[model samples]
Target: MQQRDSIVETRSFDHVPESERHGTVRTQVQFWFMVNATLITLFTGAVGPAMGLGLSWTLLAVVLGSVFGTLFQAFHGAQGPHMGLPQMIQSRVQFGSRGAVLPLAAATIVQFGFAIFFIQTASSSLAAITVDQIGLYDVLIGAVAVVLAIVGYNLLLRVEKFASYITLANLVLVTLAAVVVLPIGTMINNSAFEPVAFLAQFGAAATYQIAIAPIVSDYTRYLPSRTKGRAVSAAVFGGTLVSALWLESLGAALAIAMPDSDVITAIHDMGDSFGYGIGSVTMAVAVVACLITCSLSFYSGSVSFLSALEAFRTMKSTGKVRSVTIAIGGVIVIAGTLLLPADFLGAFTAFLSILGYFLIPWTAVNLTDYYIVRRGRYSITDILKPDGGIYGRWGVPGMISYALGFIAMVPFFSTAIYAGPVATALGGADIAFAVGLGISSCTYLLLTRRRDFSGEFDAVRAAPLNTLGEPQRSASASTDSMEGNIPV
Candidate 1:
């Protein structure tokens, strides 16, 4: 058997070594399953219908959107082992090392925003149990999550695996509650498809899944390099798809059934339905689910923040300050949630909508650049030391393409804050995601069209394990590794 990398993952910014790449595909399945199976998703699930989509149509929209979005998330998940770097670090290949910071910062916000949303949702739901001690409840959940994240990657995976198993079973109670409130027949036969609402619902659902794109590789990077991409991708998609569909559908069902139900009311209603021991278990799962939700968001956010800024490079990338960063970030998110402008659902929906637009094109470009353009080969070692990674300081095409994608979405965007002119023309339908994905991907494809004839493959190779900070000496570095000469 191959030796393990370390008892714990010590190096954060560099390529994870082969010995360290000891996790199974099941890890990917469980980590992301627990990541998505949370109370906030249930809230996200309800937003689509609240936006005016019919329950039946909203459910379909959620499924279709989640499946399509997870395609990107799963693809990103597979890169973990191959590149042995964080997802944004691999992005340095598409957008140069320095250029990579844009997505990194954006992802930081996305993660922080999500952690905030989960805290607010969880705290609100616990009002019945805590009876007026809501602040204590919020702080306690956030504190536990920070501690879990501080314990670092292995513990995060372990907790998530356990959480996934328990949540899956406990979700049955939530599912049963849903069926009792809204029957299967009602979901299937009612066909009131509002296109605008359906599209918004789809965008929101897709955004929720895709927002994880920036950090997908964080958990997956521990797998062996030879691990089949299909396995990694399948594990993530299956777990995430099933969990999201269940909670999202459940949320939509309850929202439709009790249009006036608050977060606490929803939980109380479910618990009341199963008044025996099962009721207490259901309640406990809700609380645990809250910790799981914040743990992941804060965990990913902490890593993303540490890796994005060069100032933190001197600090040990792994265990040292990760928890500290997460704790500080958690407090900020909690404070912001309380001080924010609107209700939890309102603020969160807007946050998701805004984040989705930024993420769509970036994921599109990163995936296209890796799988299609470069066929997954990258200058792994060069990505470590920022002096002169094979990606160079900036790739005009990537930076320009990212901006163009964002600009293209302006007229196509649909949100509570602002609806673009095109979105207004389309009767408020939000097709920004589709437009941004296609435009950024097509633009990137066209710009790099010469790769088929160019000797670009000469510069595409993996770095040696644990050789992060050393000079770039991989086989790929022998070629003109810098992308400066690649004509746009």
Candidate 2:
């Protein structure tokens, strides 16, 4: 074994001890984490509100956003399996140790923000249900959500496969219920909900998808590199595309019937349209499915925030933070839920619109660093340093590129102020994400022309260890006689 000292400047990726790196995370444990974290069922519940808003627009958003988001995030996911590092550490190349704080903070906030959105909507909906059963217990629902967050990611990972399988079944049942509620001809031109009219729905859908993009790697990292692309495609299709369609269509049909009802009631009405037995089961499945999503969202978001907090120089100047951050985030989410209304679209869309602004730039920067400049290879050592690292501490080129993209995007996104209609006409944050990505990619290419071609791709592109978590001694970094093979 190589007796290498830990780099004082390098941020620790995960707490996985050196000994454990060759162990646990390699097998089924991590695979399930990816699958469950991508919870398609919970995504369905979220689309419910959009259904009432406009189904056609919702579906269009999923199709466009999922395709684009999946393609970009897949590049980031490529790093996890290839480099065996967390997203924040991977980001250090682009953001610098100090500058990394911005993306980290943005990711953390969006994660926790959405966690709050999902948990609140689910809890509030559950409260409405449980109140009739146990007599006015909304607080009870919120309390249960917090407890779920405390249980953390590992437990959730174990339950996710089971939850997702059941949730898929529930989706089939609900789709049938929607058909049952409104026979094909019984409903007015269902196409009316399509994007032909309401552009806001497209913007809303794009924003929502952007909000969820960061967590793609949290799940995909577990996948073996050979199938990483497949996993990415599957997650995009199943979680975003299919799930969004379910929510939008179901919500729309319910609205057409009741006009004034919320998503929960529409679902309830769907169940009622069937017999009492089917209704009871659908309601039960919906609640459980929503809880599964909220729990995962809260856990992922908490981890992101903790990673960001750790990046702060004043905090630890490393990419790690205290466990308490999770608890605090959960509490805040719970509080937000209580404060916000139960309508999923109101809170989720508003949050996503804000998230899309920064998230687009983050994605652009990472893609530029990984694909354009580094060409899918980076020095582990360079990324560990706080300053004057190989990639250069606080990469100004990357940061400036992101800033420029953000500047261009803001006028379109912040239309409520001066350029309201102009911003709206500019096509919301989704366009911002794309345009920023293009600009950042072009900037990185133009700036790093000579430096981009030096590394040996073969040595760097070693298959990502299914088990490794800690920064092991890479072949280049090792002094041991048996340098090539990592200790089993």
Candidate 3:
């Protein structure tokens, strides 16, 4: 047994010289939990409501989105921890350092938008819960942003622990509600439980899946390489399958009881009546759980965008500067969410669609470069230095494949006009994301055959090798043993 370190440590991969330091198993598990929490929260607020209104097809649309979206995310996300770098750094192997910027920038902006969406959600909830005290909500959001910024990436682990407790408690309450309701004859015959057309069900499921695709990696990146496949399975199933079931069942039951109110209101109504003493508590728990989940969305968005900005070469160095950037970015996202009408959901979906468009091509390139082109092996050293790096300045094959993937999805997604018939047919604006993921994955694999971009492939490369200077071995490549300083 390669005795796993009890403490986190950065170690050089002997076989892959250019790879980034890898994450530990515990970090990976926490990451997976956070991913599940984030998805559950997002769906509860956005997609869950849609399903309540739309029913079967709405459920189906969200599910379909999961099928396609997860395929791309699992493949790409599984590649990250194995490589020990953000998706953008991994792209340099194929896109060339400069070429990688296009997709990185796109993903960053989209992620930032999501962060904004979360701030908007939490702030609105605070505002509503407090009777429209605008400044209070804004301050609350600002506080969260500042705290997250201060805590940095370590927050991913800490937040998950807090969220897990709330989620577990809520789960128990929901289960109890389910057990209690199942025996009631009235619950079975509720109007909200009425069956819907098959097509509509499919449409709803598709939309929900697309909406959550961009953030899949935010959680997946921390997964341990050894457990990557299983973690992906758990994340996709737990997040999409379990979440859909919870929301759908709740929606149906609530619909039957209220007959006309929204699902959240219905849930609240149940607390007033038969929920015994747990109704108010359940509602409160659910609201707080959703808020925590949204806060994570904003945090992950900040990380992704900050990573993108750092790629700019012109941005100031130091994680602190990046933290400040993330804080500012979070505020901007809130502003965008607020400036738009209360129908921010539609705009949010559109923004996500654009992100999906880019993520598809990017994921395709990532997976292809990792699995097929390199045959699941790469030098850690080549990644750091631009000139001597095996990836070279720009990989024409990767650039071509990425371009081809992007172009193919555009017409189907109708991204050129920011409107697609698929959205209309799908009954929500999430289909474009799925289409982009599928097209890009297949196209990239087809375009790039098993060809090596560079010859020398060693492990544990240094940073800023291109325009910066001669490649100095990163801390990982030092002769000193990496005992407890590995990055997650």
Candidate 4:
């Protein structure tokens, strides 16, 4: 790990030494809280009301979905301290050093998509607050986020910890003001329940929470290895659940209050209802929160991109490499935001659904391999090998399970572009994510059952200590010792 006061983080894909481990579970809570409490989540919450679900049903769906999705997401956080590597880098264990590229590519796209959406939403809110120079706002916000990402992990945590307090206070005020100013009782009375609408709302909320799975561990990987798994999981679950439910429920209320207006404009109007200048302040705070999220996506996306590249060639985790990747990602985000369409909400809904679809199977396979099959014991030296050492170039069980899980979801998928037959018969309630999770988990377990892991366990035991106190062996030597030693 880099020095505590270093402005730019030096380590990228390398393992963090025990001596450098820092941070508490409390910081984890604040970081996740700040990340989820943003305009994007508010937009996600608005989906329920837009789908014609009553506020009551929207709230119920949000609660249930948040709980279910966060359960998977929070568990990923526990993997960070144990693996001491970037989330996707650790996936090399399940998917092989090379085969991990499949999930890495998906994770990279998801992060980029999130960065684009966050920047677009923040720019729109800024435009709503002042002049309509959305193009300029896009560049300005993207530049700030890129710089913050370049500054890297420690600084990002500091910024989020500070922003968490401000966002929390502002969100509470906005939620309270909406209840007093909006005709909530009238909106609830006017709307009626539809099963399809309720399920769609539930899916939206669930995916919104699950979207963080790929990057959740990136933030926690620097913590001490002895950190309690349950403590980390609980903190993450609590932080994400509370913030998401609050902003999303507020979004549902705002959508109910003004069905035709965009969420940002509706929030502005609601803030103005409280007072004259409060709307501008509220919008400004929202922009700050969104910027933090953009930085997070850029940072994690750059790390994932590097992990993917390592599958093909040797890559260094230097500051220069990190800066270049982030710069490239920022340019893409800026260009994408400039071309954003007018139907932002509709586009956002579809994006969330698709993002969740690709990610569900990957998360399912990863979590099962970690907690069930390998039981959190991994050989870091083998994971770093170009040929994948004991694990090999492609993880047959993981790859096949991922493909099978995705295939199983095809008939149940319900997206804007295509609705599967099962989905159509069930009134268009998309439960494809759940189906993928179950299929992937079960498939990976069943396939690995007959394989012998005793040799792999011995390799893990013989591996050098993951601390600065020990001198690590060359990659060649490590690979030579493990070659032909473990059975497939």
Candidate 5:
């Protein structure tokens, strides 16, 4: 295993060799647990009560949505170790080398969008806790997050592992305090469930979890190939689900008890009600968690952007490339945070809904291709081919299925900007994600039925080559090669 003490990760958009693979499945648990236990997820939970669902119904939505969404997202973790490549790059198998630019671009936008949201919320929390200068906080937080992203994988793991303990402890204490002090019981007893609100909240919760799919593997790709798929999937699913539920449930209760205040204010007021410096501590922890998640977004966004660039031309995956992309993305995130609209919660809900529309179909097609049709068989050499190797220049099946699935969801989309006719008729309940997932999966399966993979499997068995088309050397001898640029 390579030394984990390297300050900056050297590899990006390249296959991790067995010699470089390190880390245990437990790290996956810690990383995701910390990632989800943040202000963003708490806001997601608050969406239920904001939409008029009672506390009981909101909790139901949170549980159901987290379970359903995390199941699909967790399976993607297995692909990282098996392929030894970043998540979006692996899409080349289904979408073809160049054809994958479509999904890569979409994934990049999602990552950047997420970074903007995290920074926006964190800036607000920081301003509320200490400084009143939201703009200054935005720049400071964005700069710090970009630096962490530049340092890359190993450092992210260490930071998240340490953060997992702090976040978990804070959440447990807050949950207990809310239970004893809030009017959660009254909110539950006076509950009036609306189907539209229930479904909308459910969709929001599910998509909040699903949004992690495109980037989940970026953090896990360094794990040794022998890591069990089930073990990785279980760790990811359990950790994310637990943190999301704990925070979201508390968020729902907070919304019920303090409807006029924002999530940050509500959390701060709740902590202060206990009469120690707990309010400041909780706000500080929330900001720290948000910053960590923002760094994750920038890191994965850079990798996805580079993967798109590679589809157009061959380029070395150097540290310089990663740094440039992250720096550029960080600039956009900071600007967006400053210009955010007044209705933060409403805008955020719409953003999540739109995210689901774009991502659900892609996830469905990618997962179906990985688990069913291809069954973990792929060629690193062909996937890196400029013109695409055995997979061809464009995967007609995947592209067509993705488009068809996206089109199928149009009538069911519900948001403040536009409510589709079907959604309006159903009293504004959005079930577009479900429809997209079903259509994308079945369409891709049918389209690829007669396709043959014998040649692809043969290519997989052949000796892999680096981007220069030379036979690859052993990981130990090629430690300084463009593909194996691990710093000593």
Candidate 6:
């Protein structure tokens, strides 16, 4: 096990490296619990109600979307131990090594957006706690998260373990406070189903969960190689879902109970519901929760950026590469934050809808390729190699499916920037996310001809290499079971 003070993390790329894979499965659950049980999530959860779903339907959308989205995210996280690669890089088996860059770039953009989104969330939540110091709060939270990411992964795991407990308790207190003062009977009487609004919020809620797919493995990669895929999946699913449902449902409740105000304002009012000191404490805790989520945002943004470029492929997890990645990503996020509009609720919900448009197809294809087709086996060497290496630099099949999926769902996508005719016709409901997932998954399955079950789980190697990264004497029983013959 590497010690807590490993500075080599500065030069590392995405993966935790074989020598540093010392974390326990328990840490995986804790990391996610901390990641999901935070204010960004609370802000996101509240978006459905803010979208005009009222309370009842908003709550339903939160449950449906949270469950649906976390399935992909948790399953993706499972691949970390098996593949020893970050989530986006694992797509190389299907998209080919160089072609994989397309998705990597998409994932990076999502991460960058999320980093900014949550900072906005934090600053606003902080503004309620402090006296209109959102700018200072934003910079303060970003700097701390950047430093933590630069410190690297092991220390993060430790901090997250502790944060899980603190975050959960803080949220529970907020929930209780809100519930005690809320007029549930009146809010329930005011509730009624809005299909268009329900689906719109559903997509946003699910988008929040699925967006984590690109980064979940960044934390999961430290587990032992033989970790059970089912266990990893369940752990991630349980942790993410529990918190997502709770905070999001709470957000929905706040949206209805305090319709005139946004999440930040609602939260601030909740503090005011209690005495001033208690209110101040609750709001301050929310700021801390935002800070925790930002740490995750910064760390994963760095990992996604490094994973996109081939130059950082061989670097250690704690080396100069990682430090530089964090520093650069932080600067970009800070600059973007200053430049982008600070309409927290407006910007936050809008980004999620746009996010779903991208995530649905990518998550569909990646999950389909991994679990349904390949059954999770992948050749680490082939993934690292460049052009014509089994999965080559540019595989057209996966690329085509991804494009068609995007085109297929464009009609149902609804965003402030662009709304599809279908979305507009359906009273602004956004069903494009589901359409893309179904279309892409089925399309990829047909294109691959059920290759997942055909023993071609990952890229085929012309010559087998032993686990030691050296030439092997012969094929293993398991290797022989794999389909596809390569001439050596």
Residue 299 lDDT, candidate 5, scale 0-100: 96
Model 1, range 219-301, lDDT digits (tens) per residue? Answer: 88878877777888899888888888887887787777677985446756765775654445665677788777688778777
Sorting all predicted structures by TM-score, with the top scorer first, yields 4, 5, 6, 1, 2, 3
Segments in model 1 whose C-alpha atoms lie over 4 Å from true places: 1-9, 277-280, 311-318, 337-345, 451-488
Provide the lDDT at 368 for model 5.
Answer: 94
Model 1's alpha-carbon lDDT is 0.72
In candidate 4, what residue range of length 10 has the lowest lDDT sum?
Answer: 466-475
lDDT of 5 by residue, 1-488 (tens): 23456677867787777778899998889988987988777777887788788999999998998899999889998887777889888888788888888888888887888888788778887877786888888899999999999999988888999998998888877877787779767988967798888987888788778878888889888888778788889888998999989988988889888999977788888988975666778989988999999999999989999988888889987777788889999998888888877467576657656765787888999999887887665667778777778777788899999999999999988888788899899777777888999999999999989988655554554537432223544334331332222111
* Candidate 4, lDDT over the whole model: 0.83
lDDT for position 71 in model 1: 85
lDDT of 4 by residue, 89-195 (tens): 88788888898997888888889788888888898888877899989999999999999999999989999999999988887788777878898888767657888
Estimate, for each residue in 1-488, the C-alpha lDDT of model 3 and write its tens digit: 11233222111111112332245544544444444443223333234333343343334444554455445444555554454444455666777656676776776676666555555555554443347765556556655655554454455456666766676666567656755653445543333521323333443344444444445544444444444454554555454455544555555445434556655555555554655655565555554544555555555555455444444443433445545665676666656655666665656656665665676667666765566555444444465444425566676777777777777666546322375555445443334444555666566676665544332322333433311112544534432222122211
lDDT (CA) per prediction: 0.72, 0.52, 0.50, 0.83, 0.82, 0.70
Which candidate do you rate higher for lDDT, 3 or 4? Answer: 4
Query: Could you estimate the TM-score for every candidate?
Result: 0.88, 0.74, 0.71, 0.93, 0.92, 0.89
Better of 1 and 5 by lDDT: 5
Model 6 lDDT on a 0 to 1 scale: 0.70
How many clashing pairs in candidate 1? Answer: 3
Clashes of each: 3, 4, 41, 0, 0, 16
Error of 2 at 455 (Å): 7.5
Off by over 4 Å in 4: 186-191, 348-352, 465-488
Arrange candidates by lDDT, descending.
Answer: 4, 5, 1, 6, 2, 3
Residue range 135-176, candidate 6, lDDT tens digits:
777788888878877776777777788877877777777767
Which TM-score value belongs to model 4?
A: 0.93
